[model samples]
Target: MTTYQETVAAEATIAEQAWAETFGRAMAAVAGCFARRETRATMAELVAGLLMEVDTRNCWTLGQALGHPGPHRLQHLLSRARFDHERAREEIARLVAGELAGQEVVLVADETGDAKSSTDCVGAGPQYSGALGGVGLCQVAVHLAAVTATMKVIVDRALYLPADWAADEERREVAGVPEEVVFATKPQQALSMVTGVLASGLDARWFAGDEVYCGRELRRGIRALGLGYTVGIAATYQVTDGAGHRWEARKLINKVRPEQWLRRRTGHGAKGTREYDWAWLEVRPDDTPGGNGNGNGNGNAAGAGAGAGTSVLVARRHRYTGEVSYFRCWAPGDVPLGTLVEVICRRWRIEETFQLAKGFTGLDQGQVTCWNSWMRWSLFSLIAAAVLALTAAAVHDGSERQPRLVPLTCPELIRLLRAIVLSPPARDRDHVLHWTAWRRHHQAVATACHQQRHRRHDQP
Candidate 1:
């Protein structure tokens, strides 16, 4: 059999092919904290585990790459993955910001709820899962993110609403919920995440999200910070037009502003005439979109960052393809209404990240139940997937016309990494010495990764 190494070299090799070098540096930065002794696993091995395992358990198998086996050292390196997330996010932001140095950037908020059996897990509760209706125990994390057409987005995130049981001293012991953790509203978490990104030195403006974070309180909070925002609002959320104006879509008589009052067909019974009121309004410093400090969007017209005496606001709307419902949009009067629309649309892309994280990076496949093991698996899995995504963006996504600010995606990146790691005649190469290059190259030369796709989930 022809060896992998020889086959790779025989094919047309690109110069610098520096992606491997870049990956190593990024892994080092991201995995710095997870370092144990020299005996512990390396970043490369952990990533391979993430990619191979359908779930988090692959983190345990990471030791296989280094010739280490069972009792997989899952705890030792997951800690390091935390640093990796921060670094990766920062790098992504920096790379993107550099690409659009003088252009506008959009921030979007969203959450994905995962249903689980345990109430002891952080934020676990009897919450509704859109994916699985009928109120199952679930957890949701709201991600506050920045996006641009040109670059990949990195969510500057904060995990949402910890389990109520986790905070209860009496239930703590039974459910394994940690004490330091506390219950938080998803919107509050979203704010913490956005501010966290700003603290990291990202000069971003313009934010958008679904109705979840577009509540009056959250919108008010964003405006108070002097940032521009656009978010979905409930149609029942009555807002007086311009200044102290107030009126609900149901009550307002006079105009077919359904264009202004954009509507989308929503809900289970939503059939026949389905549409939503997609409207935009301008809020003054003394005013808010949804009165009582409870609005979620910036209004119809998106505004910019506020200055002395001049307050800012946001605006925009979306009704989705299905579901008959009317969602209101809010933004300050001064912001560009057109740009707000662009920002709100950016949230759709983040879903792709989640999909890749699961199908490609093993976000949902971890089998570890140990406390230390859980944290390790969670952190490393995210990092590995992110690295793969960014790398692929750097190489394969060569569309010079589109915005190149965002990095490549996970699947594309992993293909390249594995190709190098398991390099060979990826394509178009003469057949010779199947074992020649592969055999000559010591197994130890290329880092051995965790046993992922190679394993069968037969263990009871």
Candidate 2:
């Protein structure tokens, strides 16, 4: 008998308590990261501000949100505070595992670029911004997220310093870059994060990523660690057919018979099921153990397929268009195709996490210019994002009674947090209603404009 909005409101009220509990527990986990009690208290306020909507996510604005008399304390907490950010990340890994425990937790690795116009920001240099889809001046960081069917949270991150910046002694000293911090490629950064995750005993079943991490050594290393992986590889990657003949991935996929490709729902999209034509071919087994994923050996050996390792080439074809993509995977010989597809699709969850964190919690909106500050701000941002995600998961689990109602999203949860934090008096209901109507109108116009842009593209 209750209306959808009323139910949502009730759920939001319930989720607030969950958020507070989550935040408190998370703060406790990260308490040891700060050397001083004052620093920990200030970090709690900053994280609370980040969880709520704010005009800006800098120290000045955050201090105002926490009703601080001045911004000096908050500024010191980030820029000059003595805390072990790396240890905080380790704590986060454990906390995340506790929050979203599952049998088959997935670790997704990716890098995101944060645009920085000022060169003074630590690790800020002209680098390829993946967000921009082209080369642009930005600061890039390699991040790893723990993802499950219900939620996703970034548990590890490392800033990427260009070789030039690493080599610049003056710049390094001025920006507070550590003496031990050297230039590492994105893949290497990912490997370090993966190693950290494994060391933390996070129970990750699979490691997934794009071509940036599909190098031969990386794949070998992941296998050596006894972790399964499905990573993107180039179309030109070489493999062997059943007859032991070498072929490029694209050519091999093209040779896949029509009957071999099956239309399967890879995963769920925003609207509904995402179905695609998928086909897979097992690589010729290597006579030697731990061979690179490429299949260069003859397939006629009697016990070759029963060896210790298995490699495979999996291809996905667009349902609408025949456009195909390739991935090279190394796993146990008997792993199912559906399991491979699910792991491959989990790589996109990190992108979704990035969007949610950046849009609502200012994941890339900090103004710090020191190494310590950058690390601390990122740690707090991840905590805020995890709180939001865990709370949303709780709300979603409780909203099953109303079939017509939709589950809560990250943005909606963030808005609810803002409303709870900034609850106005009942006398101001008319004013709040007026602004709410205006916001809905603005959203409608924006949605129509977005749709029109797509329509124009379709027309052309």
Candidate 3:
């Protein structure tokens, strides 16, 4: 007879097998990046080290993650390895598409900026960091990710080169910036990533981004490729009514009747469903359209008439505060309002993915100064994130019905990885337990204080 302990043991074995199979597939996807057998072996080691629990993700820390005393091999792999990171990126995209492909999957382009203190760090400059929510010294990268209902993973990334860095030959040489690297706007960078991913044969049903990537050239480019897109637009963006009347997005909000708003849940959150009221209205491009699409209405007067297709302006209102936001969507055929809303909701998945990658896999924790090294680190970190995401999907999904519980989250899976795979010694384990206990105690105290205040308010 199968006892409870035996059943648990069997389940553990199955889970481990699942992980091993997925990890093997991920490694194989990037195997062609390495030319020599030794480099291939080193690539495996680098990927495994990135998956392990470590204080940081650098050559030295990764050596520690692999239980090594030095970082020479890892350093060589990043700094002097002969493999092309771009080809590796293609493999990563292929792997992600295989794991989480759907006809309705969204291709998302967004910029992530990590604050940097050192001026010598590659691409570091005083720039506006969306991650930091303000202007600061940082390195910015444009990321292209594939997102669906079940998973989100970055498939391509490009570092943003500031105009000064691109113009200064001496600084470029010192930082090892490629000779071909030139200053391009964020939207232009996004289009290049989309073009590259398309060239690699990866497919997506829709393209999406924040307002930063919603330029005239980008919209036209996507249309030229026969792709649909839903991108955020500033409140000041102008569009024509179906009758060729021009109005800014903000102005159209007042034109929406109360009956047009639908209260819907945007997505699931840590607490519960994220509910908001949404409304949409049909709008068209101008009669003539050769402009930059920067919302300044300059360049080409053919703005709304670029494709002579249907476009929609969407408005979202916070249920509690009544705060409102807006988005513009351009899709082929008669796309349902619900479908467009779902596409807009999927935008938050990219933001959540960034949080998970940075928090668990150290997406922004590299200490490299060279351009190639930074790219290598990002590739490895993304690989680690992919493993975690795939493993979580396996553990939570599948037909094996052993026990039912809340689905595993990225943080929980990361903790399990640390406990089982990293296998900290007794002393380190004890320290972690102590830290957890302290945190629990602090939470208890805060909860008690909150309850006391509530009780007093009720009595009064």
Best of the candidates, lDDT: 2
- In candidate 2, the residue pairs with backbone N, CA or C atoms under 3 Å apart (3 or more residues apart, or in different chains) clash, namely none
lDDT of 2 by residue, 1-460 (tens): 5577788878977888888777788899989888899889878877777865566677755655565545688778777878888898888788877766655888888999888887778888887888978887788898999888777888889999989888989989998888888988888888788888888878887899998998767766676677878889889977766677888899888777999998888777878999999998866533233544345545322121545545678999998988899998767556777888888888888999999878767789888888888888888898888878878887777665367765788887777877885332222455445545655786799999999999999994
TM-score of each: 0.66, 0.86, 0.84
Per residue, candidate 1 scores C-alpha lDDT tens digits across 176-228 of 43566577787877777777666655667666777787666676677665576
Query: What would you estimate as the lDDT of candidate 2?
Result: 0.78
- Tens digits of lDDT, candidate 3, 295-361: 3343322222344444778889998999888888877666777888898888878887798878777
Superposed by TM-score, candidate 2 places the C-alpha of residue 416 at a distance from the truth, in angstroms, of 1.9
Winner of 1 and 3 under lDDT = 3
Model 1 residue 223 lDDT score: 65
**Higher-lDDT candidate of 2 and 3:** 2
Backbone clashes for every candidate come to: 69, 0, 8
Best by TM-score: 2
